[model samples]
Target: MRLKLLAAIGLAATLYSCDDTTTGIGDFVADTDEITASAQTFEATTKTLKYTDLNPNGVFSRTSNAYLGKFTDPDFGTYTTDFITQINCTEDFEFPETMQDIVSTTLELSYSSFFGDSLAPMRVRVDMLNREIDDDGEDLGLYYTSYNPEDFYNKNEEALAEQDYAVRDNSWTKEEIDSIKKANGYYPPLVIDLDKARKAKGEETFSAFLKRKYNEDKKNFKDSYSFIHNVLPGFYVHNTSGEGSILYIGAIWLRMKVSYLIESSSGKVDSLVYTSIPFAATNEVYMSTRLSNSGDNLEKLAAETHNTYLKTPAGLCTEVKLPLKEMYEALGNDTLNSVSMAFTKYKNISENSANNPYKMGTPKNLLLIRKSEVNDFFEQKQNYDSKTSFLGTYSSTTNSYSFSQVNRLISQIFSDMRTKEEPAEGWDEYNTLVLIPVKTETDSQGNTIGLSHDLEVNSAKLVGGEDGEKIKMEVIYTKPKFNK
Candidate 1:
């Protein structure tokens, strides 16, 4: 009996590629059998829900890239981003004993790309942080998208440095940029000079202050902890003036130039050596971004009953409600072979617009997970398990994000129903799922190894809502037919 059952299941598994219809076991088997196979399609209702309350706990987990500047979208409204980061200091770092004078101190913001008008002028301000990011050697727990920088530093105080610049360097020609890139492999960073004693009303320069602190206390330079807490806390980087562009800053570092005497063997000064010492915002320390969204566009879109929307960087997400109990009742005791669903995206017409030229693009990746586990999934830093959670990539050809096989998710839902005291009748919290925009980390072979919340400016309009076209879920299963 066990051999016959195994043979029947093995044959039924091959019918996964068959059309949506019922098939008898005797068709594959030479002899008549008591089992049958079938495939069915069902419409699963999905609705768009607001996903504005995102708390990443720490920004590092979500994205390594930091953002700065402000941009206003016609569809999504205005978004402004600024960041606060702790600079990492080398352990037991010390200045040269023959140091003569501080030449200059500058903050370099290095970026790979930017969104919006590259020629748009913007002023970035760097302020010295007086408060520690961590709460007395513990996690701050206030690292949300809506974090307030005023709580950490006084805005009324004089800023350490500020620079008015554009994202693209217009001074360098295209040929010059190409030649420089070919030779150096990268472009120069936007340097903001911190030693502004001549410009500001202060008596001492910031560089001299740093040198004085280092000389006064050597123990504070022991590690990043002591350095951030005692010596130099951190910096609050914000946009003080201008708009229209947001830079995708990959790394930020503070460089201090010092002129020191290089002595010869005869005890004579040979040359005045000038070099820079850098303190960077590495992964060893904490960094967070404060994101703010203005205007009533999001609220207006969320209330729409037709097409649903998906936005990123503390924006909206779509909610889907699947009829699991209905599927169970329709296909009772069937071995679910494969389950597939697709969310078609509406073609964006605003991309070709002349006025709003720099609109946000659609998110490339989407995460479909149970609504109840959304918080735990991000907080615990869990990957897609394909049971209660799944990852879907957007297809430009089909204009959809399709989950090819979700049989395990269907099986898990059925397993949960079996454990209940009574059969679940209607749609509940367990049947609902959320669609989130995510950033995926893949290996060299293009296999996704890690997942995080995408902190980019993106939006997608999916064709499924209360009054919209219902999403179709295809299910292929095999069930037994008892002999009469």
Candidate 2:
């Protein structure tokens, strides 16, 4: 009896020390006693059932990739995507002193990643845009998965730079690479050498045109808006011929290297200078997809079972339908703590065969969120959280994605119940959720800024239903007050 009293006193003191602001021991002890009593009464048990449901007609976002390519994904179907970007600099461009000769002009693109096949060959054709884009990148304007690229470009000026490319960009001579790195301070995998001579149509070449701009359209180099509108329109990069690969372009630099004879403070001297314009002033990615085989899998996915799939590039998502009505009845008027679940991926033999030659496997991460919010979430690149969403990655050792935020989600449901809002039995706004595979984007500080649902590049099959042992939720709670 003496030892038990000492233990209680020690626990009370620890709690007080942790809080440091408590004014009375009576209230603290009473709250602690209530927690202890509730814990003793309510035992946690894992419930296996459908809590979130993925409905038909999931949401899709606009274009997401930089190098827009035309590829036929066996599962997700055919897609045509292109990037329209305006180039700018934090400072004004410095043109060469004298416009004497056109030495060389080049546009280089460097990327760290690519999607689809590297073994297959593809070609990217670049052209100047005829249409004008907004200078303010505050918003890239409305983009959808069904927009067309032909509507933007005029197809004028023979190809600026055409390169036969693959996933790994290693087609550069060591000397050329060293020169590029020295000029730009970075090595670009893809290089487009602008021709110095005019085209068959007698139009000015890229270098000659820039030289003309140096003398005539000097106003264009003053600011980004003038550069994009008055002098140069955005460029359109697309795949002329390719069906099995997608390239992710990170940075683009349009530079003009020139040499001129100038009479300076000394004598007449040969001078060399370069002007760099990056395509960041404003940009938009337009994506158009032609889904051909996704319906074949959806027909099989109709039946809710232990087997469900999540395909990407906005293809298909797994739906979960939790029994919110039953949960409310079982734990009426309780202080909820948390809720968690584990989702597992199963084996699919056709994952790498001729049928799925792409060898597309499960996505690195999955998102859990309200069904209706799918549109705004992807359009804005929102994150997974306890209130409205959750994200989990695949664990190879366990072959599963675990989500443990039931209490936080359920508590929001309970909080909504206070408003007397018309409920769907137990939930106020949402009772169904779908698992979406997304391309997450982060800020410079390493915080997630948004998510892109525009690329159709990922797919996965998940094990669910009553047969899977891991497909269950464990919700913790403290019982309510009793009227004696």
**lDDT per model vs. reference:** 0.75, 0.56
Give the top-scoring candidate (lDDT): 1
TM-score of each: 0.87, 0.73
- Where does candidate 2 stray beyond 4 Å? 1-31, 34-67, 70-75, 135-141, 155-163, 168-188, 194-201, 262-266, 270-306, 349-358, 380-385, 418-429, 440-451, 454-456, 465-470, 480-484
Score residue 58 of candidate 1 by CA lDDT.
Answer: 27
Clashes of each: 0, 20
Report the lDDT tens digits of candidate 1 across residue range 277-309.
898988778787778777487788788888798
Task: For candidate 2, write residues 1-484 as lDDT tens digits.
Answer: 0112236455445433332221210111234354421111222221122112331233344433354455565444565555655566334665555656665666666754556676567787777777766634354233444345566676665666676766545666668767776886555557667563345447677777766775785676777666767666766667778667666666666766556566666675754444443334223322223222344444444444556667655456676666565565565456554456777776662443346656665688777777678766765656665457887768899888877655566666655654654585545255666666766677899776666553545566666643433345655444423333
TM-score of 2: 0.73
Cα displacement (angstroms), candidate 2, residue 110, comes to 1.4
- Give the C-alpha lDDT of model 1: 0.75
